[model samples]
Target chain A: MDLHQLWTIVSTPDNVPIVLLLFVVPFYAWYGLRQAFANDRLIAQLEGNPEMAKTHHRKIQPFKAGWTREVHVWPYLLRIEFLAAIIVTVILMVWSITLNAPLEEPSNPTLTMNPSKAPWYFLGLQEMLVYFDPWIAGVVMPSLIIVGLMVIPYIDANPLGNGYYTYKQRKFSILTFIFGFIVLWVSMIVIGTLIRGPGWMWFWPGTTWDHNRLIFEVNRDLPDLFGIAGRAGKIIFGAVVVGAYFLAAAVLIHKLITKTAFNRKIYARMSVLQYVTMQVFLIIMLSLPVKILARQLFRIKYVWVTPWFNI
Target chain B: MPETNGNDGKPAPPAAPAAGNGNGAGNGGKVAAVVAGAKAVKTRAVEEMKGAIKAPEKTDLWKSVLRVKHDETPRSRALGVLSNVFLHLHPAKVNRDAVAYNYTWGMGGMTFYVYITLVFTGTLLMFYYHPSKVVAFRDILYLDSDVPFGKLLRNMHRWGAHLMVIMVELHMFRVFLTGSYKKPREFNWVVGVLLLVLTLLLSFTGYLLPDDQLGFWAVTVGTNMARATPLLGHGGPFGPQMGMTPFNDVRFGLLGGSIVDSNALLRAYIWHCVAIPIIASAFMVVHFWRVRKDGGISGPAPVVLESEIKEPRKI
Candidate 1:
C-alpha cells in the first residue's frame, strides 16, 4: 500500500510478465532474421523460376533449378518498423513508471479531481473535437478520417510502385486535415482565453467565434440548419448562386451571338472537362466569400482573426 | 510475316501469319499487332499469376485452410500461423516489396503484430493481473519485478497496448492517402471506421485496469465523457433523464454505481479485458477476409523497374 512497497515490487527482476515480453520480443526478432536469411537463400535457388519466386503461389515446380541468382530486400523495412515499435514500447514502459504526473489522490470520488483529463493517447481525440462540431468532432470527423484511411488503397492512382509510398506522398491532404484540426482546437483555446463579447463568434453585430460555446454550437448548430433563418439563408444562397449560373448563361446566349474557331459540336466536346474542373473549384471558393458578401460588407475585421481561422 | 516459301515469296499460314512465325512483321499491320500482342501476353501473365497466388478459400473442401495444425510442435505451429495469417504482422517476410517505395509497409502489419504480442502477453498477465484495486495495482507491481518473466509480460502488455494505437492510426493514414477507399470498398471503409472507434474504446477501457491514480482518474474522466454522451452517465437521461443501455443497466443494476469505483471497475474490466478483445478479434478476421475478397493486399499495381525488366527473345 506504500510507495516503497510499490517500488520494490516494480524493481524486482524476476517479474514474469515483464521478463516474458523481453524474451518474446527478441525471440520474434531472431525469427525475423532467420526468416530473412532463409528467404534470401530460397530466392537464390528459385531464380530459374523467377515467376514462381515472385508470387506466393504454393505450387512448386520440382525441376532441376540449376540456374541461380541472388535477390533479397536491401535494408529490410519490416525489420525497421518492428525495431521502431519495440524502441517506442521500451521508451513508453520506462516513462510510465519513471515519470509520475504529480499524483493527486488514491481516487476518492468524494474529493473533487482537479484538471482531470483522459490518458495522453486519447487526448489527441479530445483535442481534435475542439475544432469541429460535437457530432463531427465526436462522431463524423473521426469516422470520415477512418473511412478515408481504409479506402486509400482504392483511391490513389499512382501506379508502378505499390506499397512503397511514404508519409509525404499525400502531404497536402494530411496537412490540411491535421492543420484544420489543430487550428480548430487552438482557435478555441485561444478564444476561450481572450474573446468574450456576445454570440459564440460574434461581438453583438460582428460575427466571429467564441471558444466556450464551440462544442455546443457545432454539436447543436448543423442539425438545426434548415429550421432556422440562418441555415435557410445558406441553403437559399447556395440555390441562388447555382440558379444565377444557369440564368447568366441563358442571358449571355440571348444577348450575344457567340462564335468560335471550332464548330458548335467541337466547342461542346472540347469544353466538358475544363467546365467540370472550373465548376468544382468555383463551388468550393464560393462558400465563404458569398457568405461574407451577403453580410452587407459592414463588418470590421478583428486584427487577430485569420480569415480561415475566423470561426 | 512468314518466311519466303521455297518456290514463291509469300507469307505462310496467311490466315494467321504471325501466329506461327518469327519476324511476322512482314504481314499487313503486323508491327502494331506484334506490339499489341506482347501486351496481351502480359495481361494473361498477370491473370495467371493471380490464379496461382490466390489463397484457397475455406469453401474448397479439397484444400484445407492453413491452420495451426495440432500435430506440429508448438514452435512449428507458431511459425506456421505466423507465416500465413499472422505473417503481415511481423517483419519476417521482407522481399522486393520491402523497399519498393510505393510498396511501403503500412501499420496494418504492425497493428496486428502488436496485437499478437498483446494476446501472447495478455493471456500471461491474466494469470497475474487482478481486476480489483485491493490487489490489482500490487499484482501488477509483483508481475513487474517479482515473477520470473514478469517484466517481459508487463512490458509486452504495456507496450503492445501503446503500440496498437499508434499502428492503427498509421494504418489508417496509409489507407487514406493511397485513396484505397474510392470504389467497390466504401462499406469496408465504414467497417474500418467502426474498428477504429472500437480500438479507441479498447484502449480507454484497458487504461482502467491498473487501478493506480492515473488509471483511476482516467476512467473517471472517460466514464464522465460516456455519461455526457446523452444517455448513460450519472447526469444523463437516466440520471436527470433516466437513460441506460441494456449492456450497462442490467449489468450494473444491482450496484448503484454512480462513480468510477468498484462497480465501474468491473464494468470496465469486462469491456477492456474481455468483451472488446473477442469482438475486435472477430472483426479483425472479418477485416482480413474482406481484404482477401476485395482483392488481397491492395497497393499500386506492381511496376518492375525498367532496369530489372528483360526483353523476351522471339521464338
Candidate 2:
C-alpha cells in the first residue's frame, strides 16, 4: 500500500491493530518455527522410524542433559519479568508523549461517518458480516472459538511436547493455530480495515472513499446457480451437498493422515461416534476459510439460505 | 638515646640509641619506637576526622524489606522470593529454560506492567474527568490545555492501555507456541484466555470515556454487533421469535438503554473505571498463582530421573 493509504489506516484507531497483527503474526510464527525446526531436525527425521529413532535418541542423550536447571525465581524469573515491565513503561511514556490519542467531534445522531468501524481487533468479525448472517458471524463463531480454545488441552492427545518446544511432535497443532489466527483472523481484519470503504464497499488500499462511487455485488448461491426452484428441492440439494462435503472430508483425512495400521489403531482407540464427531468438527472449522474465499473470489454468499436462518 | 638539634633550631626527640646497648637490640628498639609513634599520629588524625564528620547509624529496614543477606545460601535465596512482597507471586524456584529471554520473551510480564500503568494513570485522569457527555469531552480538553502535564498523563494511560491489549495477545501467542498451556497448566491457560477477554472488554469500555466521535462510533459499532447476538439481543436473528425487546436485550443491558446516551456513558464509565478492572485483577492473580501451582513456566523435562535410570545401566 502507498503511504497515503498506510497513514489513513494507521490514523484510524481500529485499523491500526489490524495492520500490526498482520505484520506481527507472521514474524512471530516464523521466529518460533525457525527455532523449532533448527533444533528439532533430527527429531523430525526420526519420526515413524522406530529402530532409527532409538539410535538417534541415544546419540543426542548426552548433549541434552545440561539444557535446564532449577534456579531461584527471585533473581532469575522475577527479575527478568520486572525488567520487561520497566522497558514497556519506558516505551509507553515515549509513545504517549509523541502521539496524542484521537478525539473527534462529540456524538451526533444526525450525522454518520463513512465506514463506521468497530475496533481493529473485532474487524475480523465485522468482515465476516459480509459472508454470513449476523447470528453466525457475531454469535456462533465467537462462542465456538472461545469454547474450542478452552477444550484444546482435552482434545489433543499427543503427549510428547509438553515441557519443551518440538515442531515435529506438535506440527499439526502449531500449523492449525497459526492458520486460524493469521489467515482467517488477521487477514480478515486487514481486508476489513484497508479494502472496505463507505457503505462497506470494496476499495483498493490506495483509493479514497467516494460517496458517488457506484458498486454492485450479486451473490448467487448453489440453488440459484443450478436453477433449482422449489424450497423442497433446494433443501434436499443443500443437505446432500453439505453431507457429501463432510463425508468426503472424513474419508480423505482418514486415508491421507494415517497408514492402514495407524488408521486401525486410531479407530480402535476412539469409537466410531467419537471419530465421526471429531471429523465433523474439523470439516466445519476448515469450511470457514473456504466459504470466505467463495465470497471474496466468486461473490458466492449464503450457500444455503432458509426462512429461519442463512448459512 | 641522645638528643639532636634540627636546622630550625628545635631539638629533635632522639637521634640514636645509647652506645652501651648491642647493635642488633638497639636497632630493633629504634624501629619499635618509630612504629608506635607513627600509629599514634594515624589514630589522632582518624579521631579528629571522626569528630568533623559524624557517621550515620545503620538500619535493618531496607535489608528486611529486600529479604536479602550477605550469606546467600540456596535456602536463603528461596526464602528471599517467598518472603518478599513483590517476588512472592512467582515460585521460589523456576526452570532456567523458562526464564530464557528467547523462550517466553517476557510478554506476560510486560502486559502486567502496562495494566498497572493504566490503573495508575486512569485513576489520576478520573480526578479531572466527569462521565457526562457535555463535561467528558471538555474534561479531556481541560486536561490537555489547562492541567499541567495532564496531556502527558492522559496520553500515557491511553497508550499504555493499547499496549496492554497487544501484550496480552502476544503473551497468549507465546504460551501457545511453547505448549506451556498443556497438561497441568491447562487451567492456567483458561485463566489466561479469560484475562485476554477482560483486557479487550476494558479496552472497549475505556474507548467511550472521551465522548468524541471516534469513541462514540467505535462503541456504537461494537454494541451494534452485540445486538446481533442470538437469543439475548433484541435485533438478533432469532430475537423476534425469542420475544426479546430493546428494553430487555443484552445490548440494552450493556449500554443501559436502546441508544448510546447518558446511561450508556455512565455504564461505560463504571465498567471502564471499576468493574472490568476488578474482575481482570482477580483473574490476573489466579493466573499468576496457577502458574506457580502448575510448577512454574514449562521447560525442559527434568533430567534427574532419566539420569538415575541411566546410572544403573552404566554400572
Candidate 3:
C-alpha cells in the first residue's frame, strides 16, 4: 500500500498500534545513541565549574547541530527536541507530499458506512460503543474507568515498590488489574462488534427503554429499559460473572483432580485463577480484537430493524 | 618493645628502658589500623561511584552530581541532560527488564517516549495554536496550507498526541500483563493510572478543538456516554425516571446545551489547551518524585554495588 492509504489506515481504525510503535522505535534508538555518544555535556560543565559554567550554553557550536544536542523543553516535558526537529521535518515533508491523499467519499450525514470505525486509536472505544449504548459504551464506562484511573495514585498508599516489587508482594491487585483490563476491553469489543447489532438499535427511545428488544436484539436497547433492579442486577452480575468464572476454573479442576468439598477460599482462589487465565486467553485471542470484531459487524449487510443511533 | 639480640643487624628497641610499658608499639599499630580503615572507605566510595554512573536514574541527584566528573564522555551529556529539570530527565541508564510487560508487551517505555515527542512538538504547535475551536481548525489549516513548518509542527504534535494515547494504553497493558501493579508499587501505579486518565481526557478535550465534523461527533458520542453510569443518581440507568436530575440531561449538560455548540467547543478548548495539561503535569511531577522516594525504580536482579558491599580486610 502507498503512503496515502497507509496514513489513512494509521489515522483510522485498524486497531493496530503501528502509528505509536513506529514513532517509538526511533525515539528509543535516539535515546540509546545519545546515551552512548552524548555526554551530559551541560551537566558535566555545570559541575566542573558551577559558578563559571554559566557559560555552558555557549559551548554548543552555532551549527554543531549537524546531528545532535536535540531536545525539547516545554509543557515541563524534556525530550529530544533537537533530534526530533530533524525527524519531524523529514516526516512532515513526506506527509505534505502525501497530503493529497483523497478524502474518502465525504461523510454523508445521512448515509453512514456500514461499519464506519472510529479514528483507529479510538476503535478501542468504538469497539466498546458497539457493546454499550452511546451512554455506557461511549461515555460512562470510559468516564468511570478514566476517573478510576485518576484515583489510583491517591488510593494506592503503598510506598514500598517504586521501581519494582517482588513476586509475592504484588499478587492480588496486579492480577485483578490484568484481568479487569482484558475482560473489559475484550468484552467491550465483543459487545461492540458481536452484541451491538443482533439488531441495530439505540439505548434510549426518548427516555423509555424497550426491554423486549434486549433479549432478541442488541444490547443498545437494554439501556433504554434499564430499571433500577436491572441496573443493580448488572452491577451485581458483573461481580457474579467475575466470581463465577473463577469458580468455574477451580471447581472444575477440583472435580477433575481431587474430590474435595468446596469452600469460600477454594471458590475465591479458583475464581481468581480462572479470571487471570481467561485474560491470558483473551489477550492471545486478539491483538486487535476490535478490528476482527469491527469487520465482522460490518460484514452483516442486512438488519431487520434500523438502529436509532444509526451509525 | 623487646630488643633483639645483636646477632642480626636488627635495631634494638628501647626495651631496656621502657620494656614494661608497651605504649610505643601500640601507638604504631593504631596508626596502621587507622590508615587501613580510611583506605577502605575510599575504595567503597569509588565502587559506589561506578554503580551510580552505570544507573544514574537510581542514584541520588547530589550523588550523581558529585560523580559527574568521573563520566568523561561527551554523549552522556544528553543522558545527563535527561535529569535536568528543564531538559530530558532520563536517568543516565535505564533498566530494560523493568519496562517489560506480559499483557500488551513493552508499551510503557514507548508511551513515555510518546509523551516526550508530544511535548516536543506541542511546544512548537503552541507557538501558533489558538484555543478557539471556531478558529482552531482554521488556524491548523493555515499552518498546513501556508506556514512553512506550520503543517509539519501541527502534524507532528497531532500524530504525536495520538501516539501518546496509544502508547499510554499499551503501557497500561504492559503493566497489567507483567503484573507490575502489585502492592508496594501500587501507589505509583495508581498515580500512573491517573496520568493515563489525564492523557485520555487531554485527548478527548483536544478533539473538540479541531471543530471538524469528525471532531464534533467524537465529542458528542463521548459526552453522551457519560450519562450511562450509575453515578450520583443522575441519568444513569438506575436514576429516577423522566427528566429527573438536571445533569440527567446528558446532552444538555455535557455540551452546555442540547448540541455541540460554541460553548462545548470553548469548554473543550479550555480543557484541552489549558486545564488538562496543568493537571497532567502536576501528576507527572508527583509520579516522578515518587519514583525516587519509592524503591527508586527496581533494578534487575539483586546486583549490589561492589563498593557498598566490600569484604572485610585481613586481620
Candidate 4:
C-alpha cells in the first residue's frame, strides 16, 4: 500500500471537504434515522391505544399539562441562532487560519491538469461523464435533478408524515430519497473526488496515481456485441433496449409502490399526471445506476447509439 | 431703609453685612448676588444629570433609535423581535420544541450566516483583485504575500463558499427527510431548489477569479460540459445542424469567448460579484418569506397516524 500516495490525496486542501463529507453524510443519516425510528415507535404506540390517541399531544417531545406550547423568540430561538452564528464563525476562522487555499501555477492553456476536475459539489456530475455522454451527464441530468426536486412535494401524495419525521409513515419517500441522494449523488461525488485520479482512471485509496498507467480493457457498444453491422439496425436495436429497460423499471417501481395497503392508499390518491411524472423521474433516476453497473460489469460504452446521440 | 442704600437706588440684602466704605460695599454686594445665582443653577443641573443617568433608555436618542421600550415583560420581549428590522424576519415567538437543536439542525440559518460571511470576505477580496488575465494571477500572489490579512481573507471566502454548498445540501436533506415540502410548502421548496442552483453557480464563477492553473483547469473542465449541452452547445447532439459554432453557441455566451481566457475571467467576475448575488438575494427573500407564510416550520410535529390519514384532495 502506498500510504504516502493516500496521505497526499487526503491532505490536499480541496479534498478536505470531501473527507468531511464522508463522515458528515453518514453521521447525519444515522442521526435522522434515529429520530425517525423513535417517532415510528411513538406512532405505533399511539396507533395501538385509541384512548391515548384521543388525549395525547401526539408529539414525542415532552409536554406537561401546564407547559406553554410556544416560547419567546428573544431568548429562545434567537439565542440558538446567535449561538449557531458564533460557532460557525469560529469554525470558519480556524479553518481559514490552518489550511491555505490551493493555488497552482499561472494558467497555461498549453499545460492541462492531468485529471481536470470541477468543484467538489459538481464532482458527481463529472463522474457521470464516465458512464454517459457529456450532454446527458452535464446538461440533462442536472436540469432534471433540479426539476425533479421541485416536483417532489407535488408528486408525493402521502399525507401522513407531513410535519414530522417517521419512517413507517414515509418509508417509500424516504427510501427513494436516500437512494437518490446518498447512494447516487453523494457516492458519485466521493468517487469522482477521491477515487478517480490521473488520466481519470480509478485508483483505489492507498494506490499510487501512476501517470503512465494503462489498462488494455476494451469498451464495446451493445449493438457491436450483438453483431449488428448496419447503422440503421444498430439504432433500432439500441432504441428497443432503452425502451425495454424503462418499461421494465416502471413495472417494478409500480409493484414496489403498491406492495402494502397503506402504500396502495397513498398511490391511489395520486392523480394520473402526478403518477406519470413520478414514474418518469424515478425511471430516469434508476437508469443512472443501471448504466453504471453495465459499464462496470460488462465494459459497455453505450447501450443506444445513433448518428445524433448515444445513451 | 438706610440713607446710603436709598442714594444708591438698591434693594436691601437680607443677610449681607453692612460695609463702612461706600464703593467697596456696593461692588461686594453685587458679586455675592452673582455667586448665589451660579450655585443655584449648578445644583439644578446636577439633579437633572443624575436623573438622566438613572434612566438613559428614557432619553429621546435611545427611544428614537430603538422605537420600543425594552423591558423584561413578555410584551417587550416579543416586540424586541418584531420591532427590529434585522430580527423582524423571525416571528415574535416560535414553537417551543423548535428552539431545540435536534429538529432543524440549524443548517438553514448556518448556511445563510456562511453566505453573509462570504459576501463580507468577497467584498474585501474584490478591493485587491482585478479581473484581467494579465494581472489576476499576479494579484493573487500579491494578495498572498503583500496585502494585510489578504491570504486569510481569500481562504475564508473560499472555504466559506464550500461550507455554504454543504450546508445547503444538508438543509435540503433535512427538509426532505422531515417531509417539510408537503402541501403548502411545495412552492417554497421549489424556491429553495433554485437557491441551491444559484449557490452552486456562485461558487463555480468565483473559482475562476484567481486565474491560477487550479482554477483555470477546473473551470475549463466545468464549462467544457456546457459545450455538450444538447442543441445549444456547438459539439452537442443536433447542434451542428442548428448552425451552432465555436463562436456562436451557449458556451460562447457563458464565457464571452470560445475558450477560457481573459473574457472568461471577466465574465466570471461580473457574474460572481454582481449579477448572481442580486438574483440569489431575491430568491432568498422569497424563500424565507414563504417559510413563514407556509406555516413556520414543518415539525418535530406530532406524528400523523396512518389511521388519521385524510383523503387526498383532488387536484
| TM-scores for every predicted model | 0.47, 0.82, 0.51, 0.95
| lDDT sort, best first | 4, 2, 3, 1
Give the per-residue lDDT digits (tens) of candidate 2, residues B113-202: 888888999999999999997789999999989998999998888777767877787777778877888778888888888888889889
Model 4 chain A scores worst on lDDT over the 10 consecutive residues at A159-168
Candidate 4: misplaced stretches above 4 Å?
Answer: B1-43
B60-153 per-residue lDDT for model 4 (tens digits): 8889999999999999999989999999989988889888887899999999999999999999999999999989999999999999999999
Per-residue lDDT of model 3, residues B124-217, tens digit only: 7667667664466676677667888776666556655665776676566544433345444667887888888789778777766666666665
Window of ten residues with lowest summed lDDT in model 1 chain B: B1-10
Interface RMSD of 2: 4.4
Against the native complex, each candidate's DockQ, computed on alpha carbons, is 0.09, 0.42, 0.09, 0.87
Candidate 2 residue lDDT tens string, A13-131:
44555566667767777777775665466554455455665544322223354554567786777677767777777887787787777778877766787788777677788888887
Clashing pairs in 4: none
lDDT of 3 by residue, A208-301 (tens): 2233555443333222233323544545544554455445655553443233322222233333444444443333223233334433554321
lDDT of 2: 0.72
lDDT for each residue of candidate 1 in A36-56, tens digit (9 for 90 to 100) = 334334433455566755763
Give the Cα lDDT of each candidate. 0.47, 0.72, 0.48, 0.90
B1-315, model 1: which lDDT tens digit per residue? 112221242222233435534545466557756765655455555544444455333223324565434343545444553556535443322333333433334467567767877777778888897777677777777776799867766655665575576556546545644445534455566677677778878877777777766677756655544443333433333333465653454224423375567776777788877898899988888887677567545544232321242332333
Q: How far out, in Å, is residue B46 in model 1? A: 52
Off by over 4 Å in 2: A1-3, A11-14, A42-68, A232-240, A252-281, B1-70, B302-315
- Say which candidate scores most in lDDT: 4
Model 1 global lDDT (CA atoms, 0 to 1): 0.47
Count of backbone clashes for each model? 64, 1, 38, 0
